[model samples]
Target: MSSNRRIGIIDIGSNSIRLVIYEINSLQAYRVIGEFKQSARLSQRINSDNTLSREDIQSIVAILKQFQRICTANQVEEIRAAATAAIRNAANSQQIISELQEYSGIRVELLSGEDEARIGFLGMIHSLDIPDGILIDIGGGSTEVSLFRQRKLVRSVSFPFGAVNTTRRFSADGDFSEEKLLSIRQMVREAIGGERWITEHPGLPMIGLGGTIRSLCKINQKKHKYSLPLTHNYPMSAEDMAELMSWLPSLPAEKRKKVDGLSKDRFDIIVPGLTILDTLFKESGCSHYVISGAGLRDGLFQEAYLTDNSAIGMSMPERSARNMLALHSCSPMAHLEQVASSALTLFDALQQTHGYDARARQCLHIAALLYRIGVSMTYYQFSKHSFYMIAHSRLDGLTHRETVLCAAIASYKAKSRVQQLYAQFKDVLLETDIDVIVKLGSLLQLAIAMDSSETQVLPVRSAAVTLDKELDITVQTQNDPSIEYKEIAALNKDFKKIWGLKLTLLDASSFSTN
Candidate 1:
């Protein structure tokens, strides 16, 4: 809520702990300022006993202390710490949590597997460009696969056997025996099978996450002289993966170092990561890994919204917006910005009178951001194109129904297209909420007319929306009543018919600014 400052998320994974500082900006954009990470491997010893050891506790304390200092120095308002895989698996995690709270003054929250996958998918999706693909987030202790069906996540599952876990069972400093490789492959195939990962969906493309895949992407990019591998959009084929896995361990550490894009931190686990991904592709018929720079960190930021609103949380709108943007075929950054500007102008003018809370405001914001996403396809009947795209978009933080509503709101601009274009979503929305969409759509229509130029804002003054007997919206402006009045009159006529209300206007003289 403060300017240039908001909160930080400290994500504790089995292998590492990280602190991220995010700023919620005026355009409703969240930006990262500081990111700090450390390798702790808290889940290292929890395999046999499913419990945290004394060493693990000490390590967590160290990470939390380090993170706290970074958060304090950065003036982070909220420090929400989330522990996954490691703490979730550990028997003594509570003891560790209490100790940290008492001695280190840090609070740690352990999340459910499903929630973790959802959030992790959020971060991963936000960090890259994969309009429609299953997100494969292979971590230290477990692998989370989330399906973005028709551009929306229909299912997600967390499987055991992560990079660190696999390294222990499959990887070796020297050449791993053929027998050892086979055994590891069998184990990975079995672990993945336990969740029926392959059986669920065939021919899915993957957007790979975690340090392992990132390191893999980095190495390949450098081999190709790709300075920025994450943004390069290199498609890693099954054959490419198999070749790399074979070559990874045979090379000594020095030889491995020679390979560009590979991080020193990821040396030990790279082989197993590739093996796991290779197996995933072999069985699931997955094509390639769309390299990702974002994963768990993005998930943690979305958690702030999730923790704040459950069932209907901060995620509902935020996720819906991001999903809409993802589904949009247009240049994601530019188009979403335009929609956000247009929607906010209308929302700000009516937020108070409508008692629009954060959730409603968030929905409006997302709808505005994704309004023209359909333009990415054919501009002809773009509104209809935009609707289906946003509805099925794989945006993090939003649920299915919210996504539909967002898509619907985006399509409200084209009248001949008929607002019935969103009849599909009517089944999912509340009657009251349907009315809200109507109001928002009405406002959008009015705003779009003012900005035929669509150049962000207009010089129109003091817009008032009142429902006295019938809904009455009056725009008091110091402009020629001729152009403004004529345009507004036409807008109000349609607004009254659709919303079942009579609309009115009162304007000041052009010479006298109101």
Candidate 2:
């Protein structure tokens, strides 16, 4: 519940140990300040009898101690450590957990298969605006599948089909032959066959989480020379996935290291990971899938945040937007609120003239919250900075399309830079969408100009739209608002160009100020 403190989350899985440190602004407003991971691979060294080898225990202890030093150096205030399937399935898990606690001074909570699936689902639902579909998390020791409709977790199941285990069990020695690949596919099918919910929700997009899925996107992007470097919400087609799977199995671990985006250490396990993903795609009939960068650590953060904050069930977008603003801005929250309020007021009053609907209004609201974000970088050309930040930043609860629109609208506040920046994203946007962004940007410019002091205490009494497509804006003071009026007059030509509207300032001294 403290502000500006660092909280660390540790995830000990079958293949790796990872720690994520987050800087908190409030209970729900935080950002990842640091992260570290090491491939301990305790699952790979587990004896056939299901007991951890002594060498495995020593390696894990060393990794945990290294993680502790990082946490201590970063002044981590609290830590929540969890161990997943590898430790859960081990016969000596209890003794290992005890040794970890006694020697490392960190408590280890073991997560069940169902709990793991739920946590992955939690991370995905809050990170993506996905309302329905099958969520798949391919881990080292298990694969978790969860079904959600409407933003809530519905049903989840975990299976023993994992990348590390399958690799050691079936494809350890050489390239995957046709017969071996077929056996692996059959195994996955048998593990996931009877889930009627997967068939019931036909055509819903698949959202994938975990390191393997992200690595696949990275490799594909590198091969295709994709312009964007972002991995979150990166779209991949089933055909594209199949193409990569076909070629990847043939590349030995040494050759795989030569690939542009594939990490050297992940070479041995990637084949089995891709094989499982390919099978899942075929079984679910999902045409394409989106990658989620957040997973179990993010879920733990959100759960911990909600327990301390009053905003437990708020819509993810609004909460995420506010958190983003809080993390980036030193400006007064009141100012941002006023700008958003004024922009929405203008949007509602001009709906008949502009003919744009609620979605446009939502974009306007987001742009208002972020328009000045670039000021943190440099006051000069701040709107351009805001545009770049919104485009590049991982804003939760917004789709790729919405992120693009928001960035366009925010950039237009700079006025002179609008056309240049708008042209850069032409491929991703339609002409009509660009037109709407311009219209909304015009309204936002007017709203921002009205609060001349950058203070929420503007003496605006009321605003009215007349039938002749004119806006009569009334301010409470009679001491001429020369600056405000001039700002509106400066944009008059463009405003009329977009909305066919005339603007006039009404004298509030002739009537009640309130």
Candidate 3:
């Protein structure tokens, strides 16, 4: 509950209006606290003259009022609401915006197609560490495709064709035909082909946003019975998608509603959505797609928190790790920092001894920071609890394997053996990886013991590792420092077994002369 403030963001899209409330502790620390979504399909209700129908306007007002009430109940400090494609293209957009503002006491900013594409792209980049990839946001009224390389947004293009619009254009009466499907595919192909940049990068995977993509992912998860329920970075292959696309259209609308991942409300629009994805897969030559649950709502939240574009293209796994610690652990942050600092230094100095890469150092640092998080639950076998928490927690910018490795290391530092953890999580981690965790965990154990004095004011004079794998460490202290040395010496057996090295601790206090 220790956080800065709770704010609400409402994204009024052509297909749905969604409200997400975020509890923000800092620029790096924020999590979704409340969410409500209603499928409006406003774009399908627009009249031929390009004006929002009165029925759609009334429905929008009702949904906004409900959102306002929820925000009030949650005591949200501020609200950021924006309307996309449908509102932007409507001739009576200003009038409807004013009326909705008066009714709900919330101003709705209309976002242009380009703005929608950019914001959706921003949201995907900040949450997922895809160094280079294409972003696809299939909305109710429009589809925004953006390209990024090396974490920077390079190009963006918005096609004025989306699920709801395409559905209405081709098949609106619950009728299905191959001709209709082909026409939808043709439209998507033409629209995407106009943006030649999508094909410029051949093998980069595509990250997908919007309701349709999430629904498809959910269905896939239900079909596969995947262990993890998270959808943020769920990956789906083109072949599997092609199967879903081929099978979904054959079902009756009512049967589609009963499908595991397909929502009842979206049954009618799903065909077009999948068709668009199929064409995109062909045009981009990408075999897999990652589903991103965060979209414009998260973009609005980040924009408000950062107050600038600083969070746009940067990858902040370290920051995300710190924030995850801040949210879960009840231990003091200073203690965590001390352990992490010492762990990283020890890993760096003993690299030649351990022969692990930079990634191993990252695992050690994260483990040290989260080593005591399990104490929040109980002191008894806290390492086991820590493992469960890390495996389940939202630690971004790390792969599933890295997350398991970090959890395993934390378990080792908590007194569980690396072999035991490897046996438990063998499906996700390798035996060699387990060896690396044990080595890093041994180093972390020494670091934590060095700071067991609790003050962390003791200076480490120097640390050295010889080519023959002998590690000599000297610390400055006024006292004999016997307790610290004894604590570190306890791990000497494992250290020697794993790294083929002898660790010797020395105190400079006894040798110094004034």
Candidate 4:
């Protein structure tokens, strides 16, 4: 098998049909290369007899044909297509599948409610490292709620009604009066009330998937003028949801369309979607709401193509750092590994003086691995470029604040530069974080200087703090070690300023002689 493969996944959702192309490397790390989405609102086309209209099925086939061509053009090695509630709940699902296959030459996998819920759970667990939480996926035709403890799926249930269908039933005219809103909430409460497990686990964070939840996250971020724009693990609260629900209905239809971060296509259906989320939030007694960028499509890809499942449930920051290193770094893996090792050695040696925790240590390690990532773009002022990339890229499993800290550490050049960068994101950071960033960044700089040659010649044999309050790092090297020594000498002033300790480097022979 080739070391690299490109796979295409088509998700036939009730509200939309999407094709996402992912390029997978040898290590099983994958990134989305291309995506296309067309809104078909298949649920709205369902007949009174619980069958999708033939016209909609034909439209589905046409979209599949186009997706197939795009996949072929992208040299996609394989395509995995799955149909969720819209087609699965149809009375003539078999006939619809046959026509779609016969026309588009694409085999469609009809996911049962259980399958959809489980797959979505898989996506959530792998993407976020939440140990215990309730997972809610609001789709166009159905909503899947799952509870997991210790990173394993405990129970899952799929509700029959979702955003599109619910809207068609209650607010088809797009005017939500007090009575209509009450009816919508009551129906959602009754549907969720049947599941006793939902209320059993109270105060657990609710991890949300699907388009509706993402829209809510985006709008909140925009409303608050949030510093970080990425949405994978964005967090809100029950109060936040209630605030949006209360505020949105007051806006006239025309005004709602003008709200920033809300897509023009979602104007009519957003209210029903928010209603579903609001009901779930209140029913589950969740304290926090976290948005997941991955959903059924990511779940499908992981189940079908990912060769290494070990990354699942691993330390999220570490996993995210390694993935970024594999996908973006221009340096050799050995060099990056050596830098990380040296930085950690220094961190552990000076832990007593710094009094930092494992979180800061993890940030330092990630920064060491990714500090050179910006070299992929341009070597000129690469540190600034590295800072921008790390700050903005989807470093999954990291809170927005932690992500900024990592970026600050990776691109550390001077205290003034870091303070300037921190100014832009002070809303998300603490005043004390500047002290942490500078200290960790100084350690990273010293580590980089130790590997200035990128030949892995100066591996730290031991690092310690002497009685005189000076940091002494001993290295084992076969070469002359002069290059590393000269580089370390240049950083001594900045290192002392940040660490409050004079710096010293001793070769193995010199240490043994002493």
Q: Which candidate's TM-score is highest?
A: 4
Instruction: For candidate 3, write residues 1-514 as lDDT tens digits.
Output: 4556889999999898999998866544667888899988888888999898766788899999999899989888889999998888889999889888987788888888888988887787777878888889999999998888898989998888889988888886655688988888888778767778788788889899998899999998889776555677778888879889889889877788899877888988988888898788788888589888777888887777655443445345566677777667567777778778877777878766668877767777778888888877898988888888887776677666788888878778533567776676665577788668877777888788777765664456677887767777676665555566576768777777767878766667656421
- Minimum summed lDDT over a 10-residue window in model 4 is located at 505-514
lDDT of 1 by residue, 1-514 (tens): 3555467888888678888887654334455678888987664567476777777688678778888888888778888888878677667767877887876787888877787788877776544445577777778888887788655667888876777776775654623666766777898777776667555667667778777787787676666564221322346766777778778867765566667778676677667667777777677777666666667777777656434222344443465465434433365464346446545665776666566676566666777767777788888888888777766554444444455566667677544333354443454455566666777777666655554444332334444555453433334443233554456567776776765556554334333311
Task: Give a tens-digit lDDT track for model 2, residues 1-514.
Answer: 3457888999998778999998886544678999999987676888989999766777788888898899889989888899998888899989888888887888989889898988888887878877788888998888888888898888888887678888888876636788888899999988877765665666878889887898899999899876556788888888889889889988877888888998877888888888988888778877688999988989877677545555467555567777778787756777788788888888887777778867678888988888888888999978778888888888777766677778888778544455565566554556577677778888888888877666543455567788877787766644555666676678877777777878766656654321
Which stretches in model 4 have alpha-carbon errors above 4 Å? 1-3, 309-314, 510-514
By summed lDDT, the worst window of 10 consecutive residues in model 2 runs over 505-514
Q: 427-488 in candidate 4: lDDT tens per residue?
A: 78898998999899989989988889989888898899999978988877767667877888
Judging by TM-score, tell me the better candidate of 1 and 2.
Answer: 2
Candidate 4 local Cα displacement, residue 344, angstroms: 0.6
TM-score of each: 0.59, 0.92, 0.89, 0.97
lDDT of 4: 0.87
